[model samples]
Target: MLPRRSRLTGASSSDRGLPNATVARLPLYLRALTQLRSQGSQTCSSDQLAESTGVSSANVRKDLSHLGSHGTRGVGYDVDHLRAEIAQAIGQTQDWNVVLVGAGNLGTALAAYPGFTSRGSRIVAVVDADPARVGEQVGDLSIESIDQLETIITERSVSIAIVATPGQAAQDVADQLVGAGVTSILNLAPVALRVPEGVDVRQVDVAAELQILAYHEQRKGHPREEAEVSR
Candidate 1:
């Protein structure tokens, strides 16, 4: 059996609440540690970790401090220890069953995505509304009709659902996911959804990021003109 430390950092340190932002960074650290471990680097300085994770050295130290100081002043952090700590904290040590809805282009890409497999999330089911796609195979899982969502959720005890349908169908799919007992949703649709109080919804708007960048770029060349137009 793996050591208790390998179970998950957050589960072990449940008493000490971690900030959501810090929790989000744990994966970045974990990925960096994985690379370091592969390279046979047993220890790493905060600066090295920060460079790999695209975070600052101070912020890395601060984030690690939340899980208690596992680093030495001169020797840096032990790779194995840091990986276990982060795995435990983010609950990645345990497998998470996930369901993907809408086997369209985006949904198919998500179903084929390798990121979730390496992390803790496993796509146990792929759901779609089209009858023709219902029995099709995606990755290792077969595409099932959305009609089977509730049954599949109950059977697999899936807690997370990924909505990859069209913008018009996003809300409807989300509603059905909620009704089927999925508490967390990662929405790839272009539209915002209204979920219940307990349901957690995370939107991934790929175009919005580009749009924001474009808005800033437009202002950079014509700041006065843009400001006057706004005024």
Candidate 2:
């Protein structure tokens, strides 16, 4: 069970409505802290963390402040305590059972990698439309038919769905997931999804990210000759 936080006066602040930018950078801090913990480090000052993550020390301090974390004057923040607080603020303290909607390449990769679920989210079921892929072994899971989507989701009480289906099939699978009571979706398909009012959807588009990086590179005096090489 997750530890309870008292919302009384002087209690620790929660991450319920953190600014978007701060919330996005929290993962970087978490990763840096995790690395420090693995290295047998005892504690980390803000400057050390800033160097590890390439963020400024002042910015790191400000971000940690949002989580109500105040490092000691000299000794700095305790690595383990800070990690646990950040994890709790991010809701990683609770177990999240996810239903993966597609068993294609992206789905298989996500399923095969246990690191994806090491924190708190676990892919409890894998679903695919292809008969050949169904019943295939992925790690400890056997790919199940798409026909079992509703049953598996409901049985596991899954609230998160990963949509890695083809671009054209994404919306249909998302509709099915919503129908199956999935409130949040991580869509890997290269398409925009339309979900109901309360359902949350996060899309990952590698091509789009590459294009954005290219734009920045061009602005930073990247020569036109580079375009020819890239082409």
Query: If scored against the real structure, what TM-score would every candidate get?
Result: 0.87, 0.86
lDDT of 1: 0.87
| lDDT (CA) per prediction | 0.87, 0.86
Instruction: Give the distance in Å from residue 187's predicted Cα in candidate 1 to where it truly belongs.
Output: 0.8
Q: Please list all clashing residue pairs in model 1, or write none if there are none.
A: 8-88, 9-88, 9-89, 10-88, 10-89
Model 2, residue 226: distance off in Å is 14
Predicted candidate 2 versus true structure: per-residue lDDT over 132-224, tens digit per residue: 998899878999999999999999989899999999999999999999899999999999999999998888999999999999887677677
* Number of the top-ranking candidate, with TM-score as the measure: 1
lDDT of 1 by residue, 1-231 (tens): 322332235343455468777887999999999999999999999999999989998889988877774488899999998888788778888889999998998889889999987888999999999999878989888899999999999999899999999999999989998998899999999999999998988899999989999998988989789779876
RMSD of each: 4.5, 5.4
Q: Model 2: what TM-score?
A: 0.86
**lDDT (C-alpha) at residue 69 in model 2:** 77
**Which residues of candidate 2, in runs, are more than 4 Å off?**
1-16, 220-231
